[model samples]
Target: MTFFLQNFFNGIMLGGLYALIAVGYSMVYGILRLINFAHGDVMMMGVYFAYYSAVVFSLNPILSFTVAVLGAAALGFLIDRVAYKPLRKAPRISALITAIGVSFFLENLAVVIFGAIPKSFLDVFKDKSILEKTITVADARIPLLTFLVIIVTFAMFSVLFFVVYKTKIGMAMRAIAADIPTTSLMGVNVDNVIGFTFALGSALAAAGGIMWAMRFPNVHPYMGFVPGLKAFIAAVFGGIGSISGAVLGGILLGMIEIFLAAYFPSVMGYRDAFAFIILITVLLVKPSGLLGKKAIEKV
Candidate 1:
């Protein structure tokens, strides 16, 4: 029971991290019907920004994290403006290929700027002593960071919920998703809404990247690759274009990952495979996703 409880908490924390990234993935897909493959790279950019701010400028973690998120949002907006805006009316394949190209460009650019060596994610928050705290549950001990991650995730999600469901901008986003041309005709600035969507998603990705770096304490040029893909899978698992589904999918994926690692130690090396397997299973069984509505086409 203790083991189960500990793993469960750990899984939830991990899921929260995935949800952060997956939300952004789903948002872009929901709004633009285009997968921003470079979304993960934006996360990587945040990690680097935070790392430099903390290590070089001697800024504390909180401020550094804030700066990182801000920088990532700007980057996302820039990417959309420069790379995607022109391709908006182009073929879907063209936009998809452009996204892939942007991903590669960011990776290589990082290599040129940061070099190939991985940087130690110096624990800037360690001195704050929050992460060092732990609580006992039966025979299990859980780190405070676990709760922190979960809390932060929900708090951010709440902000997002308010923005997505309550505001005029939220309505505009929905309208654009439904029909861009009609929304534009209705006096909504479709391009601005799309840019805001990118910024919002990129900010979430940045937060996820920072939290992930805190967990593992390392950063590299290509660090976002696998996590990005897994988060994408999580988005798919929960039903793409669905805000709630992304969260649900992320938590479920995180739990499954932890359980597999806990119970099947021998298969631990292939732990990453679990997400892909789930993706395939979800695709075969219900491509519309858990909370996703089935699309009905008028022929």
Candidate 2:
């Protein structure tokens, strides 16, 4: 029972990170219907940015995270301007391929620049009171980090919820999501909205990446690979275009992976398999995911 509780806590903490990354996927899909394959690499870039800021600039973790998020937002803006904007009117297949190409380019670029060496971000976890502490409940001990994750997730979502549903930009974003041509006809700046979407998504991905690096402490050029895939799965699992759905899916995925790793020792060796399995299972059982609404075709 204690073991189970421990694993459960671990899963929740992991879920927080997944939720962070997953929201980005859901947001972009909600607005643009594009997967933004490069989203994960954006997170990787955040880690690198934080690393450099910490080591080179001698900044503390908080300042480093701020710089990383800002850098990611800028990078995301550039990606939208260069790779995706021109293909906006083209077949979505073109945009999808471009997204894939962009993803490849960023990953390879990281390799070229940072090399294959994995960087250690041990200092991120040094401060126990901030985001890592231990508490007991019903034979289960939860870490302070778990609580911090819960707090951060709720805070982030609350802000996002308000921004997407209540603000003027939110209305414009939804308008674009429903029909870009119509939204454009209404004199909305579709390009700017798209750029904002990328920036917001990238910012969330950056936060998730830093938190994840803190938890795992080891980051490589390809570190974003699995997290990116899992986050994508989370977005789809809940509902690709649904913000709440993405968060729900991410948390659930985190829990499932944690349990699978704990109870099924053999599966640990092939951790990535769990993501594929869950993705397939969700598709087969409930295609729309837990919080996702079914998309209706107008054709």
Candidate 3:
């Protein structure tokens, strides 16, 4: 029972992290109907930003994290303005290709700037207590970082839900998602809203990336690639455009991965493949996803 509880807790922690990144994917897709392949790279950049802030400038961990989130948000906004904005009027295929290009660009840029080596995230941070400490419960020892990650994830999601449902900008976002032309005719600044969407999504991705680095204790140029892809799968699994769905999908995926690896140690190496299998199952069983509504396009 203790072992089961431990795995369950770990699953939740992992799920929350994935949900954080998945929300970014879902948000961008919900608003623009475009899959931002560069979203994960934006997360990688955030980790580097935090890394440099702490190592080079010698800033405290909290300040470094703040800088990371803000820097990634700014990067997201810039990507939209520079790469995606111009393609807004073009076909979606164009934007999709550009997203891929942007992703590659960011990855290579990191390689050029931060080098190809992996850095230890905890070793550089001045404060390691958050991650180094553990709490005992019913014979199960859990990292304090796991609790922190879960709490922060929930808090962030609360703020996100509030911003999306209770605020004016959120209403604008919803309007834009429904019909860009109609929203523009409604006198809303569609471009600003779209840019804000990108910024918001990137911020969440950065937060996820920070937690992810802490949990894994490594930061590399390519670190975000697989997690980013899995988060996209989670987004699609739960219903790509639904915020709640993203959260649900991430949690489920995380749990499945953890449990599968725990029970079938031999298959640990193939754990990553499980995500693709789940993705295929979801697509075949329900193309619209578990929480997604089917769209009825008019001719």
Q: lDDT of each prediction vs. the true structure?
A: 0.88, 0.86, 0.90
Q: Choose 2 or 3, whichever is better by TM-score.
A: 3
Q: lDDT (0-100) at residue 244 of candidate 2?
A: 86
Error of 3 at 246 (Å): 0.9
Measured by TM-score, how close is model 2 to the native structure? Answer: 0.93
Model 2 Cα lDDT, one tens digit per residue, 120-171 = 8764434545544578888787767677677877777887888899999999
Model 1 TM-score, 2 decimals: 0.95
**Shift in Å, residue 104, candidate 3:** 0.5
List the candidate 1 regions with Cα displacement exceeding 4 Å.
126-129
> What TM-score number comes out for model 3?
0.96
- Order the numbered candidates by TM-score, best leading: 3, 1, 2
Best candidate (score: TM-score): 3
| Candidate 2 off by > 4 Å | 123-133, 136-139
- Worst window of 10 by summed lDDT in candidate 3: 123-132
RMSD of each: 1.5, 2.0, 1.3
What overall lDDT, based on C-alpha atoms, would model 2 receive against the true structure? 0.86
Global CA lDDT computed for model 1: 0.88
1 against 3, candidate with superior TM-score: 3
